[model samples]
Target: MKILDRYILKSFITTFATVFIILFFIFILQGVWLFIAELAGKDLGVWLVIKFLLFYSPKMIPLVLPLSILLASIMTFGSFAENYEFAAMKSSGISLGRAMRGLTIFIISLSIVAFIFANNVIPKAEYKFVNLRKNIIQRQPAMAIAAGQFNAIGDDFNIKVNKKDGEKGEQLTGVTIHKRKKGEEYATIIKAERGLLTSSESSNLLQLELFDGYYYEELKTKNVRDEKKMPFAKSTFSKQIMNIDLSMLNKNNMDEEQISQTNSMLNISELNYTLDSLQNSYTKETQSIHDNIVKRTTNTLSREISTSERDLSNLEKERDTLKKDKNNLLSLLTTSKKQRILDIATNNTTSNITIIKNSKAAQNERMKNINNHWLAFFEKFVIAYACILMFFIGAPLGAIIRKGGIGLPIVFAVIIFIIFHFINTFGKKLAQENGIPPFLGSWMSSFVLTPLAILLTYRATNDIGMINMDSIIHQITKPFQKLFKLKSNEE
Candidate 1:
């Protein structure tokens, strides 16, 4: 390696290591804060918290790598600029581009690391993190219950333990259980001198061992139920095993399958399978939406036709009744001259019935309009994959920023990231509810940003100061004004 190359490489390495360490601590602190907040009242150990953070580190690496690269580049170049090292190198006929060659190697290496993290490590970390969260939540009931607090584990169970010993929950001076079954109510109160909780793995049962305790059991009846008290001479085992189905937990163990089959962990063949599966899933969803639209439209049309027929039948019945009333009024009018007023009343009633029928028809038309709108709305996930477009824009922008220091680079990255994130979310909502083209809506930000990123990169690389907005505006305006003046003169 050349002296200049070694010098540049050393600067990059030092800056990258320093930035990574600082960012890693920041991430850890944020993670610890979140964990602490989540487990505020629960009994979680420091080791468990540390393990959680370690498991989460792989996912953070992808985000951290890009920023680290940016900061390293900026600091290294800035330091060279500050120390006149760049000037000295330039005096020796070494161009700026040549000095940057070693840094480019570092950036390429970081990019590879980023790819590895994104493709392999991040996905596994996500899977593990999800499983870890589930495990924690499943075991939370035991961990959350304090010695004197009434703990409600489920809809029908509330328990309070006065004292808890190591591994074994014991010294239960007062234990109260209020349970409500589907169609019955029961209450059990025990004043035990000592108690122990034991778990059996073979049967998956948790047993509560109570010693020298008096048990009062009450069952609700049609009349006021009486409490039955029983005295135990020695240790009485009142074991109520929680029938927690572990099927879901067992299913969660299928992370291995995801790890084995997913593109993140798999080679070319497995990635193909994963992509095929995703495509198939998306296709199936589209097909399902199509089927649902067809079925719903058919059902809606059938209902509208049925409702119209019912309305027609009701109108016909009303017409018949009005005709009968009219005939009765004519007969009355012929018999007595005062009955002519009754004929007018019968006609008015028929008119009102006709108006009601028209109103109902209008309502049916409105319902059909609503159903059509909803059908159009549900068909928009076709564009959900368009979010990948933003990645192309974001990645290159990072490269163009040149000053890879965390400060400005991080702020810019975050702004871009947030904008992209919001665009995706907004597009999804619009597509789902408003019947927007999911593809167009979801890819809108990407479409806009890609050209912008390219333009900016080109300008930045050519040393055409990216911040020269005023000059660009003046150039554009001046050309247009000159063209307009020339046309006026020609006229």
Candidate 2:
């Protein structure tokens, strides 16, 4: 390799390494801040905390790599242009494209590496990170209950404690438990002055022994009139013992539902498999809902529904028949029979409406989950392309701007990155809400920035200013120039 290419590559690598490390650390700190609640006051040791952060750090790569490359590109090239090194190279006939050859190859390789890391490393890291959180709760059940907050235990209980002491944080003070029963809200409440937790590893139940406590339970009566009195039972106890099940939290067994449920923990192949099952399930559920509606509204359409085999077009056609013979269809029926039919129709319609309202929410949620999987699938490529995109933009923009050393470069990088990030976020949100296709949502940022990169590269290659202000000024004054010329001619 020529000295110039080596020099350029060396400069960019040094700058990229420096910028990436700093930005990565900053983002990791941001992650730490975001989840500080889970880490702080849990009594997790320094080693465990460090391990947690280490597992989490890889997830920041998609954000950090592109921005770091952009900043580094701009800084290195801007420094080169500012110092007249580009001029020296241009004098020797080393075109900008030629100068970028080595770095371009390096960038292509880097983007591939980034994609691999995203597809492979990121998923594994996410799995570990999530499992670590659960493992902490598993090994130390007390860690699951944070002080000063109502920690929910499964679907049945919400327990809160003002303070927790002892080596394993088993001793509790000012404890409150809200027990949930079907068809009731805050149905049972247990409060204690002090409590102690004891759990057996072999058993899933964690025993809570409370002292100086009171128990209050809302009583329900089968008689509707008596229920209005709002009867409740209250009692005081010097010592109380309750067992809480921690099976799901500590089972160390994989739930098939949970395994298929998480998008972040799956690789591209796994995502494809999961998405297929999800789409099929969504379709089946949707058709099932339509069948239920059909069953409710029209007994005659049962044959049509069964024959159509998931197709509802024939049932829709029957709607027009009812509309066309609206009066004739009821004319042959007896008056009492007609009234009974009308009453049944009204009840069926109300039931169908309720079913539709409930099913709509479920369908939307299912569709959103599918969209998320697609988003995750496309995001890997988008981030990989972003590395190349940012390089094109930053390297050319740096040369055009002709300023160096993180002064103007930092400002430009930040503004451009913010725009990219905002557009990306907007697209993802829109896709999540089913406003747009997930493919488009994932690539929205790249699409918006690609043209800018092309324009910048074109300008830098031809040695044109970032903006042709002189041409704009001349055009703005052209009419006046012509007017003055006419006046001079008349004079």
Candidate 3:
């Protein structure tokens, strides 16, 4: 029995490793396909690209692990059943349950490891991956700017070019540059027939050398009377050089605290803390909204009372005097005054409505972020459970199908994984939009697969094959066979 357990465990481990590698490779290729635009023609170093991919691999583990487990389990169990190893074991009084006992323990352990990875390892990896991409983008800012597009540099310059050339993108043609200072209406525009871009790794300055260009400057006077005659200056030059600062752009330097605030970069406890803070903020914002509405409504309806001391008779006289004053004010109001009052009322109403709408929009955005944090919080556990559930499903399915190798098992595993992926993606989207409860949305895929896993396991344990299509086909063709025999006899 110990030997049997070891054999099965060894087989599963080998298959799991193979399947995981293949799946991991495929997912890496897919990621490459998705981000080739960012990577291509950049001349990034081999080590740099490798480091980027390495940082990115941890994020793919949650997506890849369950599929690999499903494929490996199916292939392993299917090969055993197809080769009649299960039958041989049963004949020797070893039940199917005994064969699965060792593998089940291994799978549960894998699930725990996966959970730990999601909690501890993946968040850090995600943080690194994001920062790596940011560094790459910052290192090659010229690659990000396309030809014939206005690319703003820092706060003071906008650069554009009609054509760019060379592998390193060192050559440029038909360059247009605009320079301006803060709070200035006029700008200095430079148009060149050709240009060259160069930068150094140690310095934060980007230098552009231009040839056969003209510089045009628009000067404005501070006086309003002189603005009608704005002065302009133009000069042609054979060659010129300009230095632009690149220090302000987000570089490789990032505060870990600020980046960790993102949901993807936070663990369960961090997410819960963030969620509590967001909920408090949300509550305070809502209370502020209520207070504003009540305050505005009260202010709109209330009128100031005159400070005075009076008895009952004095109060009656005062009321009569106020009524007379109101009548006199109404009489004094002109048509323009009435129109102005109506306009003021309209404007105030419009302002209040706009404020309410903006408040609701802000609240909705905050709620979406809250939902995202909750989803991330639940996702770690869900994916861990997914690994265990997928194994149960694949192992039982493989036994029932009795098909070995990658052929039928691959098809079944892919189909199940697609369903799982779709359900999970759709549920997350629905949860983000508040269409479903965050808990339900996060666990929807697991909820769906659990029952299917149970049913397949039950059928496999009872030695029942699911819906024999061969028997159904034979039954359908039997009537045709009898009709053909009757026709032949008559002939």
Task: Tell me the TM-score of each prediction against the true structure.
Answer: 0.53, 0.83, 0.81
Candidates ranked, most accurate by lDDT first:
2, 3, 1
Cα lDDT, model 3, residue 416: 100
Best by the TM-score measure: 2
Across residues 1-491, which tens digit of lDDT does each residue of candidate 2 receive? 98888999999999999999999989999999999988988888898898799889999999999999999989999989889999999999988888889999999999999999999999988888887776776656777789999987756888999999999789999999999966775478999999998987688898999999999898878887786677778899999999887787666732211322379878899999999999999999999999978875778333222422324675566667778887654544457666766677787788788889999999999999999999999998997899999999999988877778978789889999999999999999999999999999999999999999999998898898876544765899999999999999999
Model 1 CA RMSD to the hidden true structure, in angstroms: 14.7
By TM-score rank, best first, the candidates go 2, 3, 1
Question: Per-model C-alpha lDDT, please?
Answer: 0.52, 0.87, 0.85
Clashing pairs in model 3, backbone N/Cα/C closer than 3 A = none
Error of 1 at 306 (Å): 15
Q: Write the per-residue lDDT of candidate 3 for residues 344-459, one digit (tens) a residue.
A: 66776888899999999999999999999999999999878999999999998988888789897899899999999999999999999989989999999999999999999989
Better of 2 and 3 by lDDT: 2
- Residue 87, candidate 1: Cα error in Å is 2.9
| Positional deviation of residue 157's Cα in model 2 after best superposition, in angstroms | 3.3
Worst 10 residues of 1 by lDDT: 378-387
